[model samples]
Target chain A: MSTLPLISCRGLKKIYPLSGVEVHALRGVDLDIERGEMVAIMGPSGSGKSTLMNIIGCMDLQTQGSYYFDGVNTSDLDARELAALRNKKLGFVFQRYNLLPRASALYNVEIPLFYSGMYGEEVKNRALAALSRFGIDELADNLPNQLSGGQQQRVAIARAVVNDPLVVLADEPTGALDTTNSLEVMNILQKMHIEQGVTIIIITHEPEIAGFCPRKLIMRDGKIISNEISSSDVRSKEV
Target chain B: MSVRFRVLSSFSIDALKANKMRSFLTMLGVIIGVAAVILMMSIGQGAQQQVLSRINSLGSNLLTVMPGAAGQFVRSGNVNTLTLKDAQAIAKLTGVARVAPTVRGNTLATCGNKTWTTEISGTTQEIADISSLEVELGRFFSETDVAGISSVAVIGQTVYENLFDAGVDPVGSEIRLSGISFKVIGLLKSLGASSGGPDRDDTIYIPVTTAQIRLLGKTDQSVNQIQVQVQDLNQMGTVQDEITSLLRKRHRLSDQADDDFNIRNITQLQTAAQNVTGILTLFLAGVAMISLIVGGIGIMNIMLVSVTERTREIGLRMAVGANKQDILNQFLYEAILLSLTGSFFGIVFGIAGSKIFSHFAKWSTAISIQAVVLSVAFALIVGVFFGYYPARRASRLNPAEALSFE
Candidate 1:
């Protein structure tokens, strides 16, 4: 594999103006992640982990940063260009599943495809194939509310990977799930990273949840305190 | 792009259907506004048409020469400015088809013990053709009768019912007019009521010479009015001008002085009535347009509430790669669908309401296609105008803050 990183950020900083006072959410952070790597970010609340995730996801602009995704400078893109990049190259999974309550599972999985200009039976077949990867294709016609927490999460995962994005950023993906559902979700993420060569980044406060990844970064006071690689999960086999 | 548009529309439709009652209530204002516009325009159009047709039914090429100055508000009864010689002079004009000098009086008619008082009009034989009068039972008196000063009368339908027995022929019967015995020679057809408040069927016609010599007892050749018919309606203005000049010259009136007579083309009154109706319709539509604006405001209010309620959904879509324009298109499409559906139902109701109004009020109503098309276009514009703000508000939301909102 090439040595170029999938994501690289240098001296990233974020500040918010609140009530005529400046609140520094992130002072400066530097990070790098290789392709096909499964990584986790660990932090307590208000530790700026969420802020970093938002900037890396292209949903927001950092106050001061030099960030590159696949060697393209993010600051060079406009709002619409950022949206197109998000549509084509990135995916996200949230803890709450964030599924449209009224839409069927099949339609929920089809959201990214819809934005990518895909139509007709190709869209349906791709969404169905994504759902089948998680063994929930039979529940495609069911609404989000009709499924269990585990099934809903699986559908959300199906949606996140339906477009075969370059990287998947999950924010507290297992936070709202029970132990059984959480383990099942983490296993699915692991399988997606290993089998499909998809780079994965999961944020969590739980050490056991972070244990599922091969590498983990701990953040405090808007700065990275530790970056550790687990000795047992040396499973970086390229596809 | 079209596929994305389809997706957005489906999302809009689904959202609207989720709250069916709210959607319908939001549409109510547009419905009523469009219906009112249609109803008002139809009523105005129908009244104008009816008035014109009534005036036309009197006679298409007819003009009345009244004994007053034009545009005068008040006048004394029976000015005696017109005479039979003036009618003869007008009849000699180039485009005059017929001229009848008219004399009017009120007197009691008695046949046996029954007596009823009614109006009496005196004219020559040309009055029948000029006024569109028909003899239902008998014949009109001849012009020779007028020349000989014969005391022959034609009783109208109302007079026949009042003075003569029912199912009995009144022609050739004698009826005393103000104690002067006259032969009833004909029964005039029923002409119904004029909009000017006169019962046209209640009059009796006699020879102008007879009325002047015997009944009215007038020494001079004065007449109440003159009725003139022209060969063509388009020539009425020229004929009127010619008669004015001729009369002015004969009367020896100067240019600075107003003439003592007024010549009214019935078509002018028809046009005036039409103008009044048109103004009334425009006024009503203006009021209805206010309500349509109010309805648009109602749509705006609901869309604002919808945007607030669906904040989380908007955040989710944005996170999933939907852009600002996508969010805008979704909400805008929802609002447009609501208003357009309301307009469709409003058109159906407007037509039905016009029919019901005409049936109940005994008024004529005609729905115009122009009104329908204009109102629909207006309603669509209202939807877009009102829906734009709320959709913009939705599109401008911060995805991070919106997602974190409860």
Candidate 2:
């Protein structure tokens, strides 16, 4: 087994100009996530949890920092390299599901594979398999609008994991769902981490949802305030 | 890795299909622009064709020697400047094939009880050959008729129709021109009315000597114009220069003076007509291109709006691993597809429009394959030119900010 962590960040800083004033979304943060670890980040609005997710997803670059993913320094990579890294190694689930409204559920799942330059029948079969893994293969042809909130979230999850990425980042993945739907979504993420040995990170304010993960990190004002490992009973009981 | 052409196209097609009405409206401008270009080109070419055929029919190798300086308007009293002797001199030139001097006068003709006013042209038998005029009923007046000054005439189709009943045989009949009775020896074939020109079939032909003595009351052998046919088309310029110097010498004009007669080359007139029509066609095409540009602007406008409306989708795609180039290609393909499809229907509409126009306007129109190809090429250029800006804007969008955009 590789001793190097899947994700390693040190002194990460992101300063953006908003209306001519410098706003520090992420100020000097450090973190490490090992392979096959399931963690949850809890924070209020403007606490930089979303900023951290964006950086980890390879969708943005830190103004000042070094990010190492899979033993490669991400700070030295260009935009195209970052995009390739994102396509091959990272998966993302949004708060709103963000399934393309006009695309079929199967097509939504095929997007990551398509961007990774895999096409034809193989892409279709793999997308179908991902949908089947989430038990939504019957809804493959249905558009996002035709599916319920929980079903749509399931489709989004299937899309994120379709390429078997090294890490799955869920940013308020169940924010729009009811308590029952939220628990169901968390259950699927937990199942994927345990069964497939996939690393999963969920960002949420709900302690009930965060309880599903083995590790929880709470953030405030652009820094992690608490990092704790909850008892196995809290994680196992939720599943 | 870049997306495949097929995949990009399918993505754009789906996006276009999702908003059917908006896509159609965006294409409407290109359709109208292409149609206008085609229709205008057809009309301009039709006019050129008509002019060329008309001039060709009058004889391509022929020149008209009018009794006035070139580009100067001639009054009716200026008829004495060119005479039959000048026509004889021109006929003797090396490149000249035939010459027919003619005098024209508008006179009333009365046959039986019917009276109609028409133009009377006095010329020799060579006029029939030079003008390519065929006799439908009887032979044209013979050379003997001109030498003897016989009171014989050849009636045109329009004059015959006006002076006598339709069923009547006007040949071997008598018609009075300016109160002078003449025997109708032949009937000229109908040449039909030319656009914006005089009716060619509404005139009468008679022996020049007879007209000079009996009707025109001219003691001298003065004629209005001389028609000359050249043996070869290539010798037109040399022959024209020869005629100019000969007329100047015969008229006793000094070296500094312009010749009293104007030698108009039929080929030069044809070329000038072609140039005019070419400019007209270009002007029309330019106007149509402006509309095409406007259509391109319309595409840019809608694409900008589309980028804005689909910001969240773009963000999502980027998050899922799409780079700037992928996003750029997607939107570019959409714009190109809209223009290409619009141009296709535009070609159909243009062809149909020209056909309908020609049918009702009594004008001829021809749609060239080049015009179709050119419009399509222009549409493609427009698509690429206008689509680039919006696509770049979409591609430059920051994924994180875009994802959070409402």
Candidate 3:
């Protein structure tokens, strides 16, 4: 494929006006992520790792930076264009599993495809296939409330990859899970990366969760302080 | 776009179904408002129809000439201003078809053991044709009876019913009117009570000359009123103008003086009554519209609550790929569906309510297609008007903040 980075950022900064005072959520930062890479952004609460994730997910604009996704400048996109880009190119997973509480797992997986303008039997078949891939096909008709945390996360992952987006952003995907479920979810993410070559980014404050990724970026005070490739054989041990 | 709309509508339906009780409560306002509008309109229309029909029974292209100025109350002593000669002169006009000079007085009539006080109407045979009176049992008095001043009468249905027993033929019978024995020659057909007016069938018809000479003991040939029939409806205004000028000239009235006689067009009275009922209908509909607006406010209130309650869901949908327009459409469709369904039931209840009211109140009621269509259109407008604010609010929500919202 093209020898270009899938996501590139330069001097990204984000500030919020809270009760008449400027709160700096993000400082100038530069980062690059290539295709087929699994990266983790590690930081505690108020460290602005979530802010960076929000910007990278195209849900918010950086105050003073240029963000490029798949070589396209996100700063140049309008609100509608950003939504379209998110729909067609990116997927998201939240710590809460973020599945629609009222909708069945199958319908939740079909949401991205619906926004991408695919409908009818094709949408249904693709959603079913994604659910089966995540081993939740039998629970496709279950609502989010009816499923366990691990099953709900699997449904969320199925939905994130249902449209085969360019990248999947998981912000604290294991934050609300037990250790057994967290490890299982991490293994699934690893298998998705190694087998399907889907780019994955996980944001977490736990070192154990960060250790599951091949590359980890540590953040402090809205600035990325370190970027290192871990030699740990956690993937082989987990898979 | 169509497929997207379908999906959005389905989403709206699901949301509404999730809170069935709340949705129904929100729709209750619209239902009551529409039903009230329809019932009021039907009542107004029914009253107007009853009035027009009663006026129609008096005869088409007909005018009544009273003794005083229009809208002025005339005393019994002033009732003799219109004379038989004036009526004869009116009949000789180009557009005039027939004229019947009449004098009426209430008198007690005795038949066997029954005695009822009824009106005695003195007129010529032309009244039969002008008033469209039918002879149920025998023919009306002939011209020979008028010339001879014979004390023969044609009894109306109400007078006959009151003076005679059930199934008893009053024709060829004798009844004492105001101490004068008169032979009944005919029986007039029954005419139901006129709308809010006196019972027209409670009168006895006799020769005008006989009443003036024998009963009234009047030496003059003056009469109380004159009923004139016109040949054509289009010639009514011309004929009325001609008669006014003729009466003014005959009465020797000056240029500045108002005419002594008052001419009333039956059609004009009908038109004025129709206009009044039309206004009543509009007024009633307006009041009902206020209720509909209140219902719209109820919808807006519920929609606002729904938007707030589903903020997290909206954020999730946006994260999955829903744009602002999609969210707006979903909420708008919900409002529209609520109002439309409410209006449907409103129409049903309105028609049934009107029927029940008319049955119990003994008043006629008419429901028009225009009314139904108007209400449906009005409901749709209300839905859109009230639905817009909440939908826009939901669509404008910030996805990032919304997702993080508790």
Number of the top lDDT candidate: 2
What are the clashing pairs of model 2? Answer: none
User: Which tens-of-lDDT digit does each residue in A24-118 have in candidate 1?
Assistant: 87889999998898899998888899889988888888899888988888999987778788887888899999999988999999988887878
A best-first ranking of the candidates according to their lDDT comes to 2, 3, 1
CAPRI band for model 3: medium
Off by over 4 Å in 1: A1-6, A16-23, A64-66, A71-73, A229-239, B65-83, B92-96, B103-120, B134-140, B149-190, B201-206, B209-225, B231-263, B359-362
lDDT of 3 by residue, B1-406 (tens): 9989888898899899889999999999989878888888888889888878877877869988888877787673466678878988998999899999898788899998899999989999999999888999988998899989999999999998899888987888999999899999999998777757889899999999998888877667888889999999999999999999999988889999987889989888888988988898889888988888888889999999999999999988888888899889999999999889889988998999999999999999999887888887898899999999999999999888888889
lDDT, model 2: 0.90
List fnat per candidate, in order.
0.56, 0.67, 0.58
Reference-based lDDT, residue B117, model 3: 98
- Model 2 over residues A8-96: C-alpha lDDT tens digits? 98999999889999999888889999999999999899999999999998888899988888988888888788888878788999889
lDDT (0 to 1) per candidate? 0.88, 0.90, 0.89
> In TM-score terms, which candidate is top?
1
Clashes of 1: 0
The TM-score values for the models, in the order shown, are 0.85, 0.84, 0.84
Count backbone clashes in candidate 3. Answer: 0
